[model samples]
Target: MKKAISLLGWIGVIFTIIALVLTLLTTYHFTYVKYFNDYYTLQWSIFGTMMIWAANMMVFRTNFKNIVYPITCVIIACATMFFMYMKVY
Candidate 1:
C-alpha cells in the first residue's frame, strides 16, 4: 500500500510539473484576440490548478519532506490568478 501510494505521489508530481510548464508557456505567449476565442487558456489554467492541488494532496499524504513543491504551486497559482484578473479587467 505504501509503495502504491508513493507511486501515485510521484505521478502527481509529474503531472504538476507538466501543468506548470504548460501554464508558463501559455502565459508567456497567450494573446487575448488571436487564441483566446475558444477559452483554451482558461481550460489549461483550470487543468493546471487541478493538477497542482492533486500533487500537493498526494505529497502531503505521502510524507514528502520537501515543502518546495507546494510552495511553488501556491506561487504559481497566485501569479496565474493575478494575470487572469488583469486579462479580465
Candidate 2:
C-alpha cells in the first residue's frame, strides 16, 4: 500500500509538470488567450494538488521539515488563484 501510494504520488507529480508545461506553452502561443482563465485555473489546481501529495510523501517518509515546501507552494497557489480571479473577472 505504501508503494502504491508513492507511485501514485509520483504520477501526480508528472501530471503536474505536464500541466505546467502546457500552461507555459499556451501562454506563449497566445492563440488560446480566451481560454487562459480556464487553463490557469486547472494548472494551478493540479500544481496545488501535486504539492499536497508531495507533502504527504514527506510525512510518510518521516521527513517532517520537508513538508514546508509543499505547504508554501499551496499558499502561493492560493494567492495566485485569488489574484487571477480578481484580475480576470
Candidate 3:
C-alpha cells in the first residue's frame, strides 16, 4: 500500500508536468477564455503552482525527502509566482 501511494505521487508529478507542457503549448490558442489571454505569463506561473498542488496530494511512505519534496515544491512555486507578480524582470 505504501508503494502504491508512492507510485501515486510519482504519477501526480508526471501528470503535472504533462499539464504544464500542454498549458504552455496551447495557452495562446485559448480564445474562448479571455482571462487566459489577459493573464498569459501569469498563467504560466500558475501552472507551476498547480504542479505543486497536485504533488501535495501525495500520500507516500514515511520518509523525510518524500514529505519535503512536495512542500518545498509548493514553496518554490509560490515564491516564483510572487516574484513574477512583482514584475521582476
Q: Candidate 1 lDDT, tens digit per residue, 1-89?
A: 55665575566657556555655555667533444454346545554664556465555554556666666666776666666666641
Q: After the best TM-score superposition of candidate 3, give how far the Cα of residue 62 lies from its true spot, in angstroms.
A: 7.1
Weakest ten-residue segment in model 2 by summed lDDT: 30-39
Model 3, which residues run further than 4 Å from truth? Answer: 30-89
lDDT of 2: 0.63
lDDT, candidate 2, 9-89, per-residue tens? 777777677666656667778545444434665556565665656556565755667767666767766766776677642
Ten residues in a row with the worst lDDT in model 1?
31-40
Candidate 1: regions farther than 4 A off: 1-64
Name the runs in model 2 displaced over 4 angstroms: 30-38, 41-48, 51-55, 63-89
Model 3 Cα lDDT, one tens digit per residue, 6-54: 5655665675565555555556674343333334445454545555454
- Error of model 3, residue 60, in angstroms: 7.0
Q: Which pairs clash in the backbone of model 1? A: none
Q: Which has the greatest lDDT?
A: 2
Evaluate residue 12 in candidate 1 and report its C-alpha lDDT on the 0 to 100 scale. 60
**How many angstroms is residue 26 displaced in model 1 relative to the true structure, after the best TM-score fit?**
13
Mind sharing the TM-score for model 1?
0.39
Candidate closer to the true structure by lDDT (higher is better), 1 or 2: 2
TM-score of each: 0.39, 0.51, 0.39
**lDDT of each prediction vs. the true structure?**
0.57, 0.63, 0.55
